[model samples]
Target chain A: MARRSEHTREQLRDLMLEAAEQLIVDKGLAGLSARAIARQIGYTPGTIYLVFANLDELILHVNARTLDRLRVPMQAAVAATDDPEQQLLGAARAYADFARSHPNLWRACFEHRLPEDVAGPDFIDARIAQLVELIMAPLARVSGAEGAALDAAAQSLWSGVHGVCILTLTGKLHMVGGQATEHLTDDLVTHYLAGLVMRAAPADAR
Target chain B: MARRSEHTREQLRDLMLEAAEQLIVDKGLAGLSARAIARQIGYTPGTIYLVFANLDELILHVNARTLDRLRVPMQAAVAATDDPEQQLLGAARAYADFARSHPNLWRACFEHRLPEDVAGPDFIDARIAQLVELIMAPLARVSGAEGAALDAAAQSLWSGVHGVCILTLTGKLHMVGGQATEHLTDDLVTHYLAGLVMRAAPADAR
Candidate 1:
């Protein structure tokens, strides 16, 4: 009997999350509320508290799901190419594509502000590290920089790519004219990788 | 008599914007409303509409002020150094510094989404163009890639640096450990510039 009840509880949680995700997709983070989630799932508002500590926790869970979705394409992009440069480009393209396709979901991942004193859960940090690891493989190959240098390179490069994604999505990049997001992504990766290679080149090579 | 009335109107406009800015600083974009602005300024909500077209217009004006404030440091950073590379670096550092110091205002510049059917005002686009121009001069000196190539380089590099600023400000960078935003900006500019120089290098130089 206990096992059956546990399974039901798990099912209820998933249902609420799905409803919350749908709400966010339609209305954005500002539109998400515990009462709204409960209404969508046909449960009482108090039921939401029973499942999650607070709305912030539910948002974090939603963001985690978004990150998980993002990870799949990124991993595939890396696997699709053996060339380090191509891998970097593919990953960047995948990231941009994901953001373009799911603007609200993608934005929610970054735009949701945590309370000032609260640190994000450890699992979310772990997920971010996992995403960074995807880039580090190619970055390590391109820069030949190891340990701390390799980590810094990965962070910097990803941040650059992410910036392009944000601006492009928000229409800020429209001022650049005629440059598609893909072209911009390609340009960023090509030039940035070329730069890393140059720095790693022997001094006498210049 | 008309001039005196016009002066009063201008003063009222400035007062409302100041109130809006303060509200955003304390509570973010969601906290900003025509009602809040009027409350802060000791005026009826109707007075805000009298000065601006609507809430969106008022927000745009506030963002314009933020951009104007941002321009000061960016211009100063460029003038502080003659080296093209240092100028780029300085500008990037200044950008990150500005975002850090005026996070709410800085974020409002990007966070406010215009309605899909509406185009951003020409003046806002001009302001963005001006910011890009600051990068172009130093980039033109560094890459020697003229015309479209120069434009592409400038946009890509700035986007990359902007990404670093976004992640750093939002606390995502903390997951990567103790790397300072300044170091990340330096690393991005140095490596990306090196890449551009290499791409521009003659085949025989290789």
Candidate 2:
């Protein structure tokens, strides 16, 4: 009895996504191709097409997992803390942690753009947006920074976390010495969030 | 007789370096291969070799120019300010400006790993080290911060600035609106420095 689909559908789906992710880690998105993925999984390109719309869609699919890695940790961190400020900072710390833990996947999430059919103007899905929203939601409630400024600060927070994450990914930061990554990330999160909260004493910092 | 070596040694050197820089700006470092560069200026790759040795040598040659790009502005910023704190801020701003102004070149300077022949342990280069030393020299004078803790604080500052520069480069900050990049970078710089300065004053923050 030859098993054409020996793996269950869910298992096959994970295998496909995992293969695509490892491909990106081994070779950047530029090097990804349906044939390459098929070779990795012992499937024909047709099988890959059955699983993914194309490489861009495939990457988007894997990036969702990367974002999930970030979101789950952040949610747990937020849950761990009762204070809003600490929760926000904790979310930031979790972000840096995920980034360090999964540097390649993290890069694919931020740097990878998906095909139009798959992502549209927003993203591969609402997952990253949802995570960003979770981070900003508390700040928005407390600061009253609506629409653009709130959005800007939210985006700024993304960069703040991301900035430290990528630098720490590189061996370059090793020269700076001892938990510099953690300390610097903590500083950015605390100060940037504090600035957001400083709406109480609003000045021309705008 | 076509005018033999029509360009002077220095003239030809400048022209090739200029072409290399333009290629970096228009395309990334990946696009700045020797063949691509030779075709751009209608010079044979041999001519480029005459100016420099191998690709690694060529990159070092380029950084000779790249460091100039980084160094001059910092020098000018330092000249313009006398207030220690403001001077510090301006220098940080200048470092950011250098990155923004020459994206490809900065990418070249930081992203490339120097070959082992050049990057020996305890190896420090004058160009970048000079700039970092200048930025941290003020903190060295502030008597409040002593020995190892001060070293840690200054290292954090460098990491923060480097972190911000990288995040901005990848276009990750694009989604956030309202002067986000500049504002957030400034915020990170100010706050990280503030935290460093506050290390002496802060009995309660602990």
Candidate 3:
């Protein structure tokens, strides 16, 4: 943990991000600060400011990394099956597993908000779009949905699955009636998809 | 404001909650504290503590009130229609409307986590159970779902609707693709219910 004598700017940035991610993992977002990250990495607070535009920028970068990590399991789940229902279910399960295993990190990704003056970064949006497509593809196959309807379908189903994980992690799920999280998730995906298929082709339904 | 000598403990507790709620409305949960609440209500921090065990307890009380306030619209929405679909939709709309109007209070209800040593109060659970019943009743009517399946259905759909509101308020929904929050919610409820009906009487489907 020596000072930055040998590190390039990119290397220093990576080091700072690694140290910050560890701090967030250990303490959660409330306790995270530029000074804390700097201290953990043996650098001055000023050095962190030099690498990132601000604290919000640093947090966004951290969230972006978390999103990238999240994509691995989702991709594998999608690739593991040709059946769209199983694919979607696999993705949902992977999502829940990721959140459970890295509760602090996953929470930080959503809980950290950019300030009013700063626009949301495009990279975060891009990452989210990628994740949503994992659902949208299977959703399209299941429902024959396309255009705005398909988009709406994907977002809603994704939100439902996301909600199940979030409520479960926060202990809100148990407040109503403690069903198993995985069961609720399966119930959500299975039922929502069934509903989607029924609604998809009016002629077929009739 | 006069000092607390004129008021009984219960009355004083009411005053403190009113003041704390106003503070939360203006400043969100980050700035809430006993000192701030006491200062607003013309009492010392010790006086505030006398009425509540700790800050976490006070927050739980505030969230309970929010839950109560939320039930008004949900109840009205359920009563307005006999159709199960409309009933569920009305309740979902009421929920989204409440979140949009009282974003801070609604967020605080979910966002506030009790300390590790302090167990969540029974009253909060009671309030949530009442709220979930609004969805469960219509859900039961819609799908002929009963018992554990009924319970899981109600909880998952509720979570999906809640997820829409949270992500919409937090700007995370737009990151995936900026579909209308209401639309996503409607899609979730409609499709999930359809799926539920299909699954509930598998014998009928064949």
Considering only chain B, report the TM-score of each candidate against the true chain B: 0.93, 0.81, 0.94
DockQ of each: 0.72, 0.24, 0.77
> Candidate 1's error at A51, in angstroms?
0.8
Lowest lDDT 10-residue stretch of candidate 3 chain A: A173-182
The candidate scoring highest on DockQ is 3
Tell me what TM-score chain A of model 3 achieves.
0.94
Task: Give TM-score, chain B, model 3.
Answer: 0.94
Each candidate's fnat: 0.74, 0.21, 0.82
lDDT of the candidates, in the order given: 0.85, 0.66, 0.85
Q: Which ranges in model 2 have alpha carbons more than 4 Å from their true place?
A: A1-16, A27-35, A42-57, A111-121, A124-128, A137-158, A174-178, A190-206, B1-17, B41-57, B60-64, B113-126, B139-146, B174-178, B202-206
- The alpha-carbon deviation from the true structure for residue B26 of candidate 2, after best TM-score superposition, in angstroms, is 1.3
CA RMSD (A), model 2: 5.5
**Best first by DockQ, ranked:** 3, 1, 2
Q: Candidate 3: give its CA RMSD in angstroms.
A: 2.3
lDDT of 2 by residue, B1-206 (tens): 14337877677677777788888887767667888777766777778788777666666667667877787877777678776667666776777778877877887776555543555122325665566667666766542565655555455555566556766555445553224546766666554555455445566742
Q: lDDT tens digits, residues B1-206, model 1?
A: 12223437889899888989999999999898888887777777888888899999999999999999899999999999899999999999999889888889999999898877898898788898899899999998988878878877888888898898888888887533224688888889898898888788787865
- Candidate 1 local lDDT, A28-131, one digit each (tens): 88789998987777777887788899988988998999999999999999999799999999999999999888988899999999988898898788888899
State in Å the error of residue A72, model 2. 1.7
Q: What DockQ would you assign to candidate 2?
A: 0.24
What ranking of all candidate models by TM-score puts the best one first?
Answer: 3, 1, 2
Clashes of each: 1, 0, 0
